[model samples]
Target: MDSPNVLLLLTTLSLTVSSAISGSVVEDLANLQPPSDFNTTIMKNCQHNPSLRYCNSSSVDLKEIFRFTIVASHLCNESKNPNCVHSFDKIDLRNRPKIAPLYLSYSFFWKYCPSTIFSIDLSNTSLKGSFPTEVLCCAQIQALDLSLNGLAGEFPIESFSPLTNLTSLNLSYNYFSESKISDSRFFKRFNASSFIHSGLISYQECFKESTSLTPSMLRAATNGFSRKNQIVRSEGVEIYKGTLRDGTEVRIEVYRDCISREKRQEFVEECKVLVELRHKNLVQVLGWCSNRNKRAIVTEWTDGETIEMWLSDSAPPWKLRLKILSGVVAGMLYLQENWPEVVSDIRIDSVLLTDNHEPLLSRFQVGDRYRNSKKIHWFGIFLLEIITNRRSQEFERGEAGFIEHVRENYPENLHEVIDARMKLPENIFDQAKHGIELGLMCTDQSISKHPGLDQISHMINKVYESCLELAPQNHKRSHGDGEEQQDDQSKQQKTTPERSETGDTVYNITCSSQWIESAPVVLKMTSSRY
Candidate 1:
């Protein structure tokens, strides 16, 4: 299971699949494995159920560096030729999904190209031929690893300027004279260490020259750092998905060894801390794996909408907006009142809403090492996002973010940020405005003055509670203006007018006393008397 090492995993999974299908009604696949192709090596673990086929797989191999080498041999059929150029616009490698070349192996896969892949890995390949100079075309190249290769000659500066987007450049372990590139005008702007491990100011390059043209061979040859999977799962946890002796579907997110030891340990500590909280508003962290070899987090994946998607997509109506914000406040309050030590990093993407609109907060604090003003900024930003439906990053008018809306016309008509689908009840219009004012206050540029998570919760509670007390129904439109909202109240008034067990009338406000033939005033009931 380590790095999935496809050559080995294919054999193992095939046998497992064959055995699994025979034991239970569920069918497994060992015979369905496909022959390896230049694009991918698919070893199936398929379970076909008339309508569909399900399969799970781990990626095998990744280009430590993706680049090109100069070919001394004519086998170097230079298709782009004499040019020795390969376009990133041509490497269609990611489409295969299941296949990725590791280290120098990626240097072997330059046939299909991509137009915009900057970060490439071509380490650990003894690719001969001079370096393919044309890959400099990838203007967006940032991190490139071409370490541990057989490359020589003066490093060219013209080949690098096109890749101005680059930040981390690695060209260690090569044949070039260290002093040459160190003093060369082209390599001077970058750090001396970027050309490490050689007599020449060395840089990594592609394994193959143009004997056969490929997409990314050149890019990998330049930047000499490995581009392996950096996102890791937690440690000590096994990814279980079969039967558990019982009939239930086993589910788990196992940790992978991609994260640093420290972060993994922090993740584990956070999991341990979160396990102590029993609140329903906070997501339950069932368990976590924190062993040094591997690390990962295991929390239930709620099958509903995320707050960002909910707002940006299928936008719910105005009433629903209040309801959602209310749920968000209730959850935050529960966390602060009970688990303030751990809950932090409250941002729009971090908060989720269930199908019923109950909000659940995630990515809370587990370890003390990684919490601070960022947390306040995050929580305040979350509230600001809910109020403005604009990301906090856009707060300044520079990017036109949520707060920018208020900045353009605040204390004047702050309703612009409110969801167009929602309505402001007559009485709580002020409260809604007040809440927005608080959001504007909370999302201030001066981090020092921004409200804390608890204070944000308080502001929302105060604004909403006061608003509800005054308007109860949440809006103030009459039959002509608020007829749509009053429909719900009208039903409630007629059905259980007073919440009576038998559904009795709650009020006897005589129309005769209020209505005159010439001027019948609509009874503006201040609050729900029923």
Candidate 2:
């Protein structure tokens, strides 16, 4: 039947409830379903179980409609009878076994209703005021249509978190124009039609497209982009910390030398590319502004140290270091696989380290020279830098570089060749050697002789997995002198591994990854002999 007929059927059902129930309930149900023509509207195809009266109605108080129906129809006490079908006006059960389940959808439907609600159609209803938070109560509601109604205020994007089963949502022709949603990840599936005529919802906001920010907004966010707000001055780019009008923290990158027309065009083109790229391991470019001879890109702010600063600050464990390396590699792989171009400049300076020691690759485009250079060979050089703890450029003037250095020193003192920042676990010497060997394989001059990126990733995973397994069982005490040293030796002699500064075992870090991957709760890495 048409939607108008559906509304008419619901009105008739409400009238029936009013006629059967007490005078007070009749008034309440009357409030739910406003006065409508009773002559033309009738419950045409309703099939209610005699013992347990169940019914469905729209254009009524969604919260109080079911309560009124239950009290008026003698289904109040039959809550335990799961097989009992409910009474509804014009609902054909033969064709729609789906609608039979959602007869008692309300605040606590799970505890009261027999079956799950798969869909809810409240279109052209009296649903008004704030967007209903109660909709989340329907955990199994997959398809929702709240169109052609009164829904105001900024829609709570977070309110939909519990409805993991929701597949389709429609809120078109509603009053959500002034509503501002900061994060767009929640509404990825909904198209422009769902939010059409709602001025607040736009393509730039929903898809997280790079908005054209006004010069004034940028200035207000950054305190006029003053030196006080400057976070970093790297590669002729001055980065300043700022917050949007909605209180979103952002990092504003002002190009100090994009004065040339060619440079400005490059910046604009790069912004186009950056807007398309979205990954956890890369900085998110929010928007850009090119006004009054100033060129700047606004991105999501992360209070992270550069890889250069991180390595300089303190020696991190091999497991943590390898995770950072893996993230960098993954980011590069994503760029290579998805985008037309890769992150040409992969170095310590290009990688940012989170507080928890995760890495994010920045500076995506390589500009003029790198765009023309042999790109695939650069990743091998990046790998060599991590293994040798030396910058790739430094290897150019040095004696034989990392590849040759490893070739001469392997099978004997692999420990000495590895970065002194990490003390290799004695139990996994071959694993560590294999990692170094893979790095060497990447740096091979012959392109055919070099290991593929996938092969390199697999080998790194093996080494990373080994480090995770052995790190928990093995503990090393800080080497010192006198009584403190002896005390450390006694602690190291114990079977349990040394706890970190956080007082948690190194195994805690390793276990988090294992659980994240849905792997076995415990992993056992035994000797080759075993």
Candidate 3:
């Protein structure tokens, strides 16, 4: 009997040992998987409540973060508390989990934390469904962003009435053209751009030439076309800063009297192109007024100055500079893929900076389709200019031109090529160097050698990620040490570049029956020569 009991104990011990080994092997396999895959699996088989997750308070990963009560109270817009506020924090979860579906049903928050919800941002999340009306239950909701989703069908206009406290609502880039609001007052809260491309506004309402404006209205808005109102006076066009009787700020561009019939036709083509193109980065065309004696195009007033002017006055941090360049890249991607003609005249002056430092492209013109080399070369030069803070024209006369200068001068540490005004950390210098290398790639003289817009966008995005990863502790300002690096708030004026002999820098905007007409002048340069 004793021998049989001992045998049974030995057998059970052996089985327990085997189970332990198997468990170890499974954990090792999991560790080998990529973080994204691991997170995906976690999301698929979450043991806890799948709809919501509170941080593990005991975990050191979020030690610097205030306790949930504090964080939740602030998000809920309760009065500030000393325990909730902190002057410093050091939590950096570089490899955090990514949840699938990339969205939370509005009802989930309503059921779990209704009063706690203050903001919901799900832009570019690949969400596909009807808009979540359950969000109305979150009474304290201040900001809601559902842009860049696959959501279709008409929105229930009446549902928005309960969201009276909502300060910001962004529903752009969704399929809701057939959507209608019973109350015009709801429409009053948002800009026209929100409804653009959604088909809420008719095509005729978008690009109706002759803004129903007599010459008198233009003159009246521009103080009788006075010199004070003339913001930009280029060879082919004069831009006037004006305010309409309805309090809308506008930039009125009046073409020169010497505009030929062919150029007028070209302007129409450009306008047709511009009317169809609606992007946040492009300076949007509101309407145009055409008369026998005078022709004018109206654009929304860009609140900030041209990039050239802003760079001159303020030395924005390297991170902000990368953000500005990224915006320009987005504009470039849209122009390259969508426009019928090549953007051969893409120069630094074409970019405008808004009050919040957002970049906008202006002075759009359509040229030959095959001006790829010229376009790429100028884009490269533009990148170089951003890095070196030197004007494109300045690089022409020197023996070591822009391309040569970058290669020779900053070969070891490309961040050395950066403008002295921006004070960034050494850790993010790698990101700055990556941007410089990309600029060189853009300038590749081989007509077919340059990276496509998609590739360029990807590379820029990587650089942006790198910049974002640099911890706040790493940053050191050029002026006063610490957080108060930016204080310059002076606004600069925007302008178009001087006209070139090749073509009119500013062209007339109109729509014509014939799309094609003349051959465009092309500038060819070899990227290999650099």
Scored by Cα lDDT, where does model 3 land? 0.54
lDDT of each: 0.43, 0.53, 0.54
RMSD of each: 25.8, 19.1, 16.5
Model 3, 1-530: lDDT tens per residue?
Answer: 22311121122322333244332122232222122233332333223323333222233222111122222322222111222222111111111113213113223323324233456655556666777565565546766766666677767777777677777666767776464442467666655555555545554543443244677888899999999888889987899999777566889988767566676666666665665667767887766666555678888887788888877878767767877877787887878877747363446676888864668888776666556556656677877788668775677755137677776644343445666566554444434544565566566443245655665566566556555544554434442233323222101111112244543332111111111121221222222221
In candidate 2, what are the lDDT values of residues 346-408, reduced to their tens digit? 677777887646688767673334431244356655665665576645567552475666667
State the lDDT at 29 in candidate 1.
Answer: 24
Which candidate's TM-score is highest?
3
Off by over 4 Å in 2: 1-204, 233-236, 258-263, 366-376, 392-400, 447-449, 470-530
Q: Which ten residues in a row have the lowest lDDT in candidate 2?
A: 88-97
Would you give me the overall lDDT of model 2?
0.53
Distance from true position, residue 234, model 3, in Å? 6.2
Relative to the true structure, candidate 2 reaches a TM of: 0.51
Candidate 3 clashes between residue pairs 3 or more apart in a chain or in different chains: 177-198, 267-508, 267-509, 267-510, 268-510, 268-511, 445-527
